[model samples]
Target: MASHPNSSTVQIVCHVPDTLLDGLQVDMVLHSHAFVIRKTGSFRNHTVRRVMTRAPIIITTIRGGLANQMFQYAVARRLAYLSGGHVVLRLADDFEAQHERVFGLRHFNITGHVMYESKLAVTLQQLFPAHPQPIPEKIIVEREYQEFVPYSGKPALAGLKTLLFVPELLAWRDSIQLAGYWQTERYFADVPNLIRHDFTLKDPLDARNQAMLARIRSRPSAFIHVRRGDYTSPYFARMFGSFPPAYYHHAAQILRTRFGADLPFYVFSDDPAWVKQNQIGGPDAVFIDWNDDAPQCDLTLMAACRYAVMSNSSFSWWGAWLGERPGGMVIAPRIWFKSIPEFQDVVPDRWLKI
Candidate 1:
């Protein structure tokens, strides 16, 4: 017989001879000749059962923009898949005043559960004891990309529960509270099809976007994404600096060689004026600037293109991944960050890096 420390139940395992086990009653008696009885003590109030209940939920905090949010959700989804538990997204609204970021996962067709900060606090208090102020009987995993150096091949954390993920770490079968960027496909490569299904847009494309999609599919097309909003800032640039113009020049040359110089090219950027000022696009290139209010529509259009020349941003990374065509070409920058080494797992093996 075995018992769980935190549970109010007891399990009994026994083997009996077939002849001596005749007329055995599982509910009332053990056998016709012998009877089983329980002794009353500390476990008197406990109920004996054959199996245990379902595993606890794994709660992961969701932060950042659309692409970063996808990474966080993918990690939590993979962990839940391995542990046979559900995942609850803890929406990080603290940055709303500064970044003006809103929860964008609802726009997708994902079926996971989500909880706001107010409801998460209440649920945590009700489930666990009050001794632990924030979360009780839970593991807190934080992102430590800056301090923890990669390429060392060291374990990110020692314990199985509370962990700090630097780059990527395999999750064991345990309910944990995860908070990280998890900016790599290797973390959840086991469920790529499921993740793609979850990332599908819930709403249909509008008229303008549908027209753009048709244009993209009509002939040979290429997408060039220029990410330059926060990346231009001095502080942010030191970490995630903008890719040089030479990288784009090289990528465009490769696409032109593959699909001919007359191929139509679409330029997507946060600052279209910068693209115009630099004359980055070719003669046939069309600048996409009307979908500022609907960024997801822009992503959809990028995905419909035949080829992609991506910047060092998750937003473009997702676009290239989603819009990939059969025998299509995707060219990315060799260096993702100025300080950190190249994230080998972020870009797929098949994609070309210049």
Candidate 2:
């Protein structure tokens, strides 16, 4: 994202780091400090262009780990794609470094952004004109995952039922802020190929992962995720309950019925000790416990397997999505969360909810 202004003329040449799925290359021409893009081949470089007084600033908080970052990013990317805007993934808290959880979005080739802000509302205030109206907490509240209410015509202080897309939130225009953990593919459903490309790792797997990859793809395989780490706590357990061994037992059974009795099960987990103690993936299943320092490798191996038995965790949810092949099976828990007893849109319709 470099801009070179011709010293001899009033033209500005800009190289887009990368645009959305459209493969659109944009070149910006500076006009009075206001900016926009020019499309060349249904996308463009330096022709007459589209002008924007203020492309809306779609701000979202970046918290949790990789999967959570992915959710936050994908939703923000979709919003910016739909209505013109610049994406801002703000660091919501400082606890991530202490937890050894990095902001994983930078590892992927993603789009729809100007900056990843860390300060609270200062960036928004600096970017936008002085407030036309006061914003309550400076975020627009989307009522829930179920309802779609158009923006109420303010710099909305939005809050809501999260983990799934709600369309009414799209009505928000101009500078707006968001704070939610958006899961599920519905937001980017129409462009699965685009999302896939965007989420693909920018680099190849390491030596350990490459060896694991070969091993995973060699057999009639299924991957089981036992997500325990934080789920053992009282708060997380009550809000989002951990899966019991029974869930994996039933899922493995289903996979065995389809793939044959010898189908090898590869287990991935944050707490492999707990997994072994509970015999979550069965006594014969192979435990993949070395990638705690590099969870992406674990995710890669999970995606390579022919079958996936996911826990309620988003980490495995992503692995299953990336690994889904023709004639493959993905088994999700019938109950994803203890708080929301009814099923959410997190699981795809084609996946078996057992």
Candidate 3:
């Protein structure tokens, strides 16, 4: 019998440094390739064949930080699963490399297999009958990451519960009036798995979170995440303009008026103490325990919250997306920054910008 061309086979190349290998799993490796058919009972008169996929799924931190890397894995996994193939990570996308490299293939020294699918391939693949549909048409307008243009279906990864907050990706973005505004929104709103990654809070804070979660007692409750920081500084809120203390003050007032004090309000932030020091804590406001020794609760707590008050940072964006707050509020900065007027429209409709 002739082998089926659709039979899947994969070779993976790990893109991340060996140091973080412990965080990955073998099964995840299996999740990165196109599905292939494997013939069972070889060399027998009564041989049977069944579809099998044990392809390699490689992971690399080519571009961006932990969030970007996670996104790469999620996309690779989804493509492999949907295409009936395996996955692989070309680490070449890792640390910024010299401009003269030969792209993901030559950079990663991958000769055995092809990179997931070309941008054209991905786009053309959308024409076929794929699950979840081709991410709607508006998912690719004004995308910040040109390098990832081929991976246009990225937001679709959100459905896998993997969230991304790439403020830096917006560094090049000077305007949001561009068509891609809705594209980013769809990605942010469409989440399936949402892996939490914040390590900012401590155990006592988690205990407080548990208490707060318990307090709802069937009452509709939401988590209000407020992040205040220097907006002008290129390091943090460079894209979303500045989320001045005034916004926090105004938001707090609104929360007070809308939710009232009976519903417990849990504050999770990089600078929780700062909020406590400056903003007046409400009667229902409970500051979760956060200390240096606290277990890192970046994505964990963000995922648990029913609602979110996103910071100008990508970190908070993931929080809001993962919360999946039905009828929830994700308050973001209306004006990202003065210089980067481009970010004005970067936020989604679900967000109540201050």
lDDT of 1 by residue, 1-354 (tens): 765343432434445454433333222133423335332111111121232324545677777788888888888787777666556777633545534765667667765455555556654433322223433244434435222221113443332321223433464566666666777777787887777788888779888788889988898788999999999999879987997666777789888887888878899999888887776657567999998767778888898888999998998988888877687999987778776664456777789988
Q: Candidate 2: lDDT over CA atoms?
A: 0.66
TM-score of each: 0.73, 0.73, 0.49
Off by over 4 Å in 2: 1-53, 93-100, 112-165, 170-175
Which runs in model 1 stand beyond 4 Å of their true positions?
A: 1-53, 93-95, 124-171
> Per-residue lDDT tens digits of candidate 3, residues 259-336?
765544566655666767765345446665552232224444555655566656555665566565566666776765
Q: In candidate 3, how many clashes are counted? A: 46
Which runs of model 3 end up more than 4 angstroms from their true locations?
1-82, 85-219, 226-241, 280-284, 289-296, 337-339, 343-346
Model 2 CA lDDT for position 194:
64
Residue 330 shift from truth in candidate 3, angstroms: 2.2
Candidate models: Cα lDDT each: 0.67, 0.66, 0.41
Lowest lDDT sum, 10 consecutive residues, model 1, at 40-49
lDDT score, candidate 2, position 266: 92
